[model samples]
Target: MTNSPKLAVRGLTKRFNDLEALSHIDTEIAAGEFISIVGPSGCGKTTFLRIVAGLEQASSGEIRLDGRPITKPGSDRGFVFQQDNLLPWRTILANAMIGPEIGGFGDKARVQATRQLLKLVGLEGFENYYPKQLSGGMRQRVNLARALAVDPEILLMDEPFSALDAQTREIMQTELMRIWEEGRKTVLFVTHQIDEAVYLSDRVFVFARRPGRLQEVIEINLPRPRSLAIKRTPEFVALVERIWNLIEYEVRQSVLEEMS
Candidate 1:
């Protein structure tokens, strides 16, 4: 962990043929900072994160990790996709150990690390269960554990809780906050949920549609260990309202442009 940003994006742009997914994206995710990107569908939030993870090539611009150019995928960044994407054949513990195994860690150390992560995510007793044996939320917990197995310096998540029930999503959000605070890991999260973004992020980046330009950045002044009670606070509501007002206009503009 460097004193500077663990991940930095400078004028990052991504285009697919004539469709520009991200344009001039500039953001810095400092070490141990929890940053969330919120935008409407097709706003290119996903594309932006994918570029950072080196899953998609950007048309121009550059990404750096601790001042070093990021040109390909490696263990420096861990990604948890929208779907849990667990392996059905493997047990939860086995799935969680995959990253460490692939990275050539010793068996005992990987098992110990995976067990600790699973415990942190509240799946301690279910380590032997397969993916199909677990619920959506449980599978997601496994997904999170797997990502942390290699101890990556950064975590890039793309709406990893969007598919769960409201209750499950709430639980997972709290769990995510716990995991983040415990490890102080740098995170770049993407989601369409305004409340989710506001609750989880130290700073929230809003994106405009079509080409996905930076709209506004909101600082979450809420205190740490934010529980559901904080979400009901006047301060939380105010933040959510402000973010919605900023993005609503952009979303309408995007819709109109598509129609036109």
Candidate 2:
């Protein structure tokens, strides 16, 4: 019996000519885990996520799922981009339906699945709404629903809530936790907010800029079914402080490099 992470990335490196986006980065996300990748801007966190989603090819790396290599986009790995990226002309239901169509599920099954997903994401009555007609958070909810329609084993998200207001971001965080708890999907989320990372993650991976590498991996010791109220606890603050201190030096170095 082989015990392998659901997603394993080894010696991952990406270079754009003289620019190194990621380097010697290694990470393993187990099945059913919610892991957050956080770092300053330009740290290659999004690039790493794109590589795993097969949206972009890595310069060099080994990506594995259940111990098998991952070389292309597949339904098993679902992706939610920062922008909703909904079809400007399509209704919310139409947007959600497209997932199943591309994923190879037939119409009836796709329709049923999309409806259930719309409900799950709290957009039940907005099925007819278009992206132009929705708020940022609402659009992100549809973005999430579309990703879920295919029932992916692992979700790859890149700062899906960064655009919303403080209140909306908090609500979305709660919603995201609810989805993770109820749906039991493995997730690898990328974000720049340390608090957001600590609040929503099982483990938080902090990266360094300019040839990004994992600087630290902090395990969140907070209780499950985490609520907004958890943010006020002393334990949460202590963990956040510990994580912040670990990344502060790297972040300062990144800024200094840019200044020079």
Off by over 4 Å in 1: 1-3, 252-260
lDDT of each: 0.88, 0.87
Stretches of candidate 2 exceeding 4 Å from the true structure: 253-260
TM-scores for every candidate against the unseen true structure: 0.94, 0.94
Tens digit per residue, CA lDDT, model 1, 21-110: 888987777888899998777889888877778888779999998888887888888999999888889899989988888888848967
lDDT of 1 at 177: 93
Candidate 1 yields a Cα-based lDDT of 0.88
For lDDT, the strongest prediction is 1
Of candidate 1, the 10-residue stretch with the lowest lDDT total is: 1-10
Give residue 14's error in model 1 in angstroms: 1.1
Q: How do the residues 1-260 of candidate 2 rate in per-residue lDDT, one tens digit apiece?
A: 14578988889989988899898888788888899998877889888888888778888887888887777888888899888899999999999887788867857867987888889888889988889999999999999998888889989999999888999999999999998999889999998788899999889998877667787889997999898999989999998888888778777877888899
